[model samples]
Target: MSTKYKFHEPTAIYFISFAVVGWIDVFTRTVYRDLLLESLSYCRKEKGLNLHAWIIMSNHVHLIISSKEGYLLPNIMRDLKKYSSYRILKEIRENTMESRKEWMLYLFSKAGQQNSNNKNFQFWRQDNHPIELDPHLNMFEERIDYLHNNPVEAGLVANAADYLYSSAIDYEGGKGLIDIDVLI
Candidate 1:
């Protein structure tokens, strides 16, 4: 009944999705998307996050991640989401170029008011829907393919590898926008 994704296995790799409140197309703006990228980079470098794959869509993000030694997945996810929400919301509020600023702020503010956890804004919805990739199942490739092909399925790109915000290029042996530990 709870809308929270809890990672049970500390060492296991997880495929997690984070969505925005009201499914807002906040990532349609380049500034916001770049901020999310910076947040991920920070988590990877300073927080000991091991990112296997990642993609930032218009309203949601998919990440295949794990934590290194001395870290926990839940804790890492918590920090990543919390930090990203504040920074993204602030950027949206301050960005004059954002044409939908008022509408976006209203939606985020309303969602925040409806939730007991948030004080002012709610950028990301609470649930991450983290799925631990079981070693026996070996669905790693399947999930990575699904993540990379999301933009293609939505008709945003002709090929999965062409998506700039994803790790698909890395899987194809090219460097991506962000450094990721390629699983496939």
Candidate 2:
């Protein structure tokens, strides 16, 4: 069985990125993205996880977050990845519009079985290198900006606010799709 590494700190600020196995565009539809938002919402309300910022791309997700209750960050990530993997795979199976269902499912299934905790397949890569946020304000701002501008840099949208799946709108004084907690 393969071993998974845990994030370094429990109450630390974390910059996490998880890619779809094979970097497949598993999140091409809004259903999977909505699943992610729902999962984050649940984590916030139930698990004391605080989401400072987040961006959901076609095949990956990036976030700056911290846990309020001192729960291990990696454990939260493991649950999030596991739940999203199951929900997204279910959606793909039932989705009529998704053309790459078979291939994507196969890839996820293969990856999951390689790991001891996974039964069928895995959707996300296991490593989530959490960077500790310095007390300096400028560094925090820089990281937040980078997260928001990622979609724009990838040419997915003209403006950061234009991306509905990111927290940029919230920080930029516009209503974003997901609710972001206070960063400080």
Candidate 3:
């Protein structure tokens, strides 16, 4: 099943989520997580992306973002997924700390083999569900709050700010790895 959405305009905020194939816990390693962070940083610096909020979970990611130059949202997600997949797979192969590398690669390879044009294991699912934000200011704030609160909701941390991989710290006056552009 293809998971793609069409946006009629480019000026609105978008909420996007992409899950690991089979919902695997591939992000237990900090190396893979760092790869994602690095990709987001590169995107911000080179792609004109305006990242408003984000949360990197064990198996998925939630992001609230918009493009300053009106670039299509799908393109941004595609690039992010592709880059992260390559780096994470390479890390899995090269890093000695990843004990479950074989099993993870088997699962990823199985999923990739199920689909055409996949030469190796697939990390992320291809479908990105992008929800167009309501034009109201309050609605945007609510979505941002929801994104930031995800880790707390999952019981991973006591507060949103405690989660190092999200923009909640930035909102709470702490420095986050990625710079966030506040919408409100």
Candidate 4:
């Protein structure tokens, strides 16, 4: 609820991070991660989301995002999160192969009931913790490095570019899961 971390500049690129409620490792599955990637793709194609970079970790995600001339970054983020949450939750509910279905649903239900903003279930934590990139400093490079190296730091992969869920591959001149406007 603090204005310090809110999205104030609509056009300025932002380094944003959001986690699942209780930091549950919901994205451990390929289907869940692909669902998030699909949502990002939809936002980019329909909502004027200028995605600079992104990474989907086991429990959270980080993105370097901005918006086109007539779009608002906050609005795009809200829609992206809301839509992805609904779709992912539905998939989890309907997935007969999901072993953690009941447990995840219970946690989401409990979280939703506790938060007045949600009607039934809560998938993502509310705050995006967006930090506008300062052109005066090296914030862009710094954040992009941090974002790409997350999997490496977590021991998920030996090399950053080897992580398929991140933009590191794109940065390394390889095609990644989602389209990104690589920063120079």
Best by lDDT: 4
lDDT per residue for candidate 2 within 1-184, as digits (tens), equals 4333345567678777778878888677888999989998888777777899999998888888888775767667778877877787888889888888888888878888888977777888877756777756566788888888998999999999899999988888877877888574
Query: For residues 1-184, could you state the per-residue lDDT of candidate 4 as single tens digits?
Result: 4698888877799999999999999999999999999999999999999899999999999999999899998889999999999999999999999999999999999999999999999999988999999977999999999999999899989999999999998989899988888887
Query: What's the TM-score of each model vs. the native?
Result: 0.96, 0.90, 0.93, 0.98
Q: 2 or 4: which has the higher TM-score?
A: 4
Residue 152 lDDT, candidate 1, scale 0-100: 100
| Model 2 ranges off by over 4 Å | 1-6
Clashes of each: 0, 4, 0, 0
lDDT of 1: 0.90
Candidate 1 lDDT, tens digit per residue, 103-167? 99999999999999999888898898999898677789889989999999999999999998899
Supply candidate 4's per-residue lDDT for 52.
93
Off by over 4 Å in 1: 1-4
Model 3, residue 116: distance off in Å is 1.2
Whichever of 1 and 2 has more TM-score, that candidate is: 1
**Residue 67 in model 2: shift from native, Å?**
0.5
Cα displacement (angstroms), candidate 4, residue 129, comes to: 0.2
TM-score of 2: 0.90
Residue 127 lDDT (model 2): 70
Q: Top TM-score: which candidate number?
A: 4
